[model samples]
Target: MTFAGSLNPSFYQSLWQDCDSIYMQHQSNCLTLQDNYQVNVNLLLLAIWLDSHHQLLDSSNWQQLQQILLQWEQKLLLPYRKLRRLSKAALEQAEYQQMLDVELMLERKSQAKILRNLKSMALNEVSSTEPESNIGRYLTLFNLDSQDYPNLGQ
Candidate 1:
């Protein structure tokens, strides 16, 4: 059997139709759940939203979406009060650790100064000489000697 003579839609029209179908399906499911005592407004809205969008999203294999939305709603609504308490606890712990780090760094700096002083004292007891009889290699890499060069000490 041959199927023929159906109109061809533009790319955007086809895309819109697919989107509309998903939305309709989600709305239908959400409305059905409204009659049940177990579904809240938040849950119904979340379900409808997820039903339409989850196919285009990723990788909890789509299983955790409901739990994730619930958690997100909780976080959004009561975050400052709850999270502030948590952050205050974390800050105190961090401050104690920071004090320990500061103490350790001060000790290390003191030790480093003692070691550097000992090193300078040892160097003061030794003698060194400049190389007076050797010639060094020269290069023409940048034609540096082609003109006057700036003083390197700067």
Candidate 2:
């Protein structure tokens, strides 16, 4: 499959859906990473998806992806997430839900941006008998280790 097609929002959403239970299982750890380490869950999920699809990116593409995700996280996701969290108790249910819907929309837009940029790049398929772990490389970007985030390694 083409990189863009494979990296669509639905692909990431489906993976997220499938991994929801795992996330919940390690919710505390995930939250700690999010709150303390400023981890972007979507990026982590993207790394997992890329590895599972055997879409090995060269260092340049990987760095570009990280930059794209960082921009999205800094400008959109993090602020909205904080808003949603802080407003949950103060806002009416409907209002909170609306905010959540907006956040989800923003997330999809970020995914689309990533997909569009990746489609433009001349990506190559993995040629080695055993491709390296994209997840490991991604975690290293955050000074994280898969051992600490067991769900990610899985």
Point to the candidate with the largest lDDT.
2
CA shift of 132, model 1, Å: 88
lDDT of 2 by residue, 22-44 (tens): 56655676678777877666566
What ranges in model 1 sit over 4 Å off? 1-21, 34-60, 75-154
Q: Which regions of candidate 2 are displaced past 4 Å?
A: 1-31, 122-131
Q: Whole-model lDDT for model 2 versus the true structure?
A: 0.68
* Candidate 2, residue 119: lDDT: 66
Predicted candidate 1: what Cα RMSD to the true structure? 35.8
Candidate 1's C-alpha lDDT? 0.31
TM-score of each: 0.21, 0.72
**Ten-residue stretch with the least lDDT total in model 1:** 131-140
Candidate 1 residue lDDT tens string, 9-114:
2412343335345436555443343333222223223222223332121222122333443354454423432454455556777765665565445433433332
Clashing pairs in 1: none
CA lDDT of every candidate: 0.31, 0.68
